[model samples]
Every structure is written in structure tokens, then in C-alpha cells.
Target: MTKVISHVGFSTTARAGDLATLEDSIRRIVDLGADVAELALFGEDLIAGGRIIESRAKRLVEICAKFDIRYSVHGLIVSNFMDAAHLDWQKAVAKAMLELCRRIGADVLVQHSGQMPIGPRPMRERYDALEREALSEIADIAGKAGVRVALENIFAVADTEYRQTPSEVAETVRAVNHPALVGLIDFSHGYIETTRIGADFRAEIRAMAPVAGHLHVHDSFGRPYTMSKFYYTSEAIALGIGDLHMPLGWGDLPFDAIFDEIDPLPGTALIMEIGERFEAERADCLAKARDLAERVNRRFAADAA
Candidate 1:
């Protein structure tokens, strides 16, 4: 059976700051049969304390032991455009974070490649360099820690129109040329990233068959013109893109078919990266994700029969 990890489980945008309240949050996620609980790598507490917070890392590992829930991964390596030195600092921070992840027995780390420049001075050159830096850093940190580092796809149409194509995203990974440097295919971002690959979601996954390790599964209904904003999600809704990251059943993403498509022979796992603020709505999201996963499994079983 394909394992599902609940993404940003305890840290919805509405309550991202309240990460200390994770006991109840983790209980709910584990109750839903999720294999892992993904938490944002940083919190206000981290902000106040410092990067190498051993106390925080110890608490994370303890919670996992108490709940029998593994800490999968969640983090954004701080990147800066104006100062390339930030990249080096972020790399050190990322390495330290992965060390924390290792201490907690977490398995995967998601980091971002730098954004494109606004005025465009050799963007391909800059992005490629950043990716190379990320890859080198991942090999040293995540690989050494035995945690996978997946580079996620970013799509902000308004922000310099950077990374509007999956090919560009894929090309960056290829350039990185490291084993731990993997691809994170967030469905909604993947849709907005390319005109050619939009809605051919499964094919896009198969295209990056070699490096894709984890999936950020969410749904959206915005086309370029309708979305003039050009993207949609609970995060986007918070950003005024659409209503919200409506639960699994609320969107038009062909999730069941997508589930059928992922073989994960190369280590890819599905993370239900949905967002709902209310406990009632979150419960609904869990039920739907479990139901959908169960149904897909039954179908696969019957097909074998």
C-alpha cells in the first residue's frame, strides 16, 4: 500500500505560529493512519531561541516516540537574491536543520532553489548556480544524515515569471547532479509551472521518473486567465488566490487516478499537503484522504485479482 504523509499537519497557515500545541495535532494526524507528521522546520520559538535548538529537536523526537509518528520533513532553506552570501549561510542553516532531522530520525527534507531575478541578469546562470550550491549542500548534509533532500517546484507567475516550466525545474535538478537532490512535484504548482504539462500531471511525474521522491498533493482550479493570479491553494486563498486548500473532495484534482499512477518504485511517497483551519474541517480532510486511499488500494487489489 502507498503510505500517505500528512503535510503541514499541525501548522496550518492560520495556526503556523502555534506549533508548540503539537500533541493534539499529532494525535489527530496519527489517528488518520498517516505514516508521518510533517511540521514546518521553523517556528516563532525557533525564531526566539536560535537555529541549533537541541531542546526543540529533542522535543520533536520525543513527540514522535510518544505518538509512534515519524517526522518526515518540512523546511525552506533561506535564500537571498540580492546577496549570494545568504545562500552560503542558508546552506549552513540547512545542514544544521538536517542534523536536527537526523537526530529526530526524520527521513526527508524539502528545500527551495533560489527565485529568479526581476530584471533578468543571466537567470539561468543564477538559478543553476543556486541549484548546484543546494545539491552540494544536500550531498554533504542530508545525504550524510541519511535524509533525502527534495527540491520543490516553485511557481509565482507575478514574481518575475520565474520557473514557468517544469522543464526549467527539471533542468535545474539535472544540473545539480547529486543523488540526494530529488524533485518535489506539488500538483498545483506543477500545473501552473508549465503550459505544455498542465493537467498532464501523471505524464509529468513519469517524465521525472529518475529523481522524483516525494509529492506535495493539493488541488487548484485556476487557469492562467481565470486565475489572472495563475495559481490556487489554501495558501493561495490566504494569499487571495481562491477560497482555500479545500479538503481532498472539494477540488477537481483527479486524485484517485493520480494515486493509481504513482508506483513509487523509486522512493516517491505521497504527502497530503492540505490546509484547513477548523478541527471539524480538518477531520473531514482526514476522512476523505483515508477513504480515497482505501478505495484506491481496493481497486488495485481487485485489479490484481
Candidate 2:
């Protein structure tokens, strides 16, 4: 069968500013038989004040050269374009991240979908326009660097209104209309958001599949965190609430069904975003992701036939 997914791996859990730990994490991922390693660069201190720290960038490049693994970077989670006050700053950081992608030979840099503080509909519309402009510019930078900017769908919470749904993200990407900009479907986040809004999970995934260039493969019960009181993550796991980021098969996410239906674009990276709590299960999680990718590829081949 033709391959639909080009890479499969887990995100690194190493602490920022620690090259030894980063190397250790990549080495472990390579040992686990993964061909890709996603660098979650948000808190990694690799960039400061919207610029790449030249010394750190050099060291990072050196460290990665020691491994044979491909890379995909998760950009700063707080880089929101919807915030008009800091829009230029956001653009600067995004461009710097694209430069990092080029320096490290990464083809994809993932950014969470834009979110805005809750406000009136007119205000929200303005913010949406700002985001489109920002993403257009960001996409240009990424394209020039030979990288794709993947805008990931995020689940909404009480404090903010995330793009919230796969269709919404798809719409935004289409509006940007840039070849370098594509959708990233984080299935766990999609599950929670779709469940919250009473939408069919599979349908939503299928709708966004065509535009998707990256996938965050993890399991989660279709539950939103709405507890009135504070509790530990263990308690949330017990209740199956929120984005648990559980290892595949540990939660009720229908991976078999979802993969059977959606065919992400060729060369899409199917990354397992399992939390650090499930570290022992990383190998198994990657195995399951490979199996799912096979399923999708088979379907893709059959459709072509």
C-alpha cells in the first residue's frame, strides 16, 4: 500500500535548556524504533524575545546531528495571533521558529490554533481577521524555509475560546489559502471538543482529513473537564475527563474507526502525544500508531485503485 504517513514518533519530555537531557530523550526515541522525534519547543528556552538564541540553536543542531531521527517542532503554545496587542511579537517568534525548523531539517512546525479572550461577536470577527493576516505571513516564511506550518486544533476551556473544532480550523486554513499552511488534527482534543458540542467525532475528523498535514495520535475519553473543584491528574484519569493524553487503547477514542475513515495528506507526520505519565508505554504507543497508519494507507491505496 502507498504510505500516507511519512513519520511516526513521540514528543520529547526533556527539560528546556538541558542539551544532555534532550540528547537522552532523542536517543531513547531512536532506541524505541521511532523514526521521528517531535520537539515541544514552547518552554524549551530555545527562543527568547522572538529570536532564536544563536548559541542554543547551534548546540541543538549539533545534538540532533548525532541521531538519525527526523524532527517536527511544536511551537510556543502561547503564541496567539488573536491578541492584537502582541501580534507583531507573535509574528516574530513564528518566523524564528520557522528558521529553527530549517536549521534542524524539520519539515513541519506545529502551532496550536488561535484562541481569543471571550468577547462580543464583532470583536471576535476582528481578531479572526488579524489571525488570518498573521498566518498568511507566517506561512510565507515557512514556505521559504521549506517547512509547513501546521495549525493544531485545541479544545476549549472556561478561560478561553480555542478555535475549538476541526471544521473551524479547516476553515481558517482554507481562508489563509497558503500551500505551506495546513491543519493538524489532535484527535484527543477533537474528541473532547466534538463531544462538548454534540457533534459526531468521526464525521468531524473526516471533514478535516483532506487539509491535515500532521496528526497528534493519542487516546482520550470524550469528556470535558467541568469539575467545580480542584483535583489531581490521577483523579481526572479515573473519571476519564478532559484531554488525558492516554496511551492508545487506554482510553475510549475509536482509533480503528477513525483511521479507517480519514486519509490525511501524504507525508503527514502521525505523532503520538502520549503524556509523560505513560512513559513506559511509549514503544507500545508507537506500535499502535504504525498500525493505524498502515490502515490509512491501505485505504488510500484502495481508493486510488
lDDT of each candidate versus the true structure: 0.58, 0.85
Model 2: per-residue lDDT, tens digit, 183-215? 999999999888877888788888899999999
Q: Which pairs of residues have clashing backbones in candidate 1?
A: 164-193, 213-268, 227-230, 234-245
lDDT of 1 by residue, 198-242 (tens): 546557655653466666766554333235443433445444343
Q: What's the residue-level lDDT of 26 in candidate 1? A: 67
Q: What TM-score against the true fold does each predicted structure earn? A: 0.75, 0.95
**C-alpha lDDT (0 to 100) for residue 192 of candidate 2:** 88
Steric clashes per prediction: 4, 0
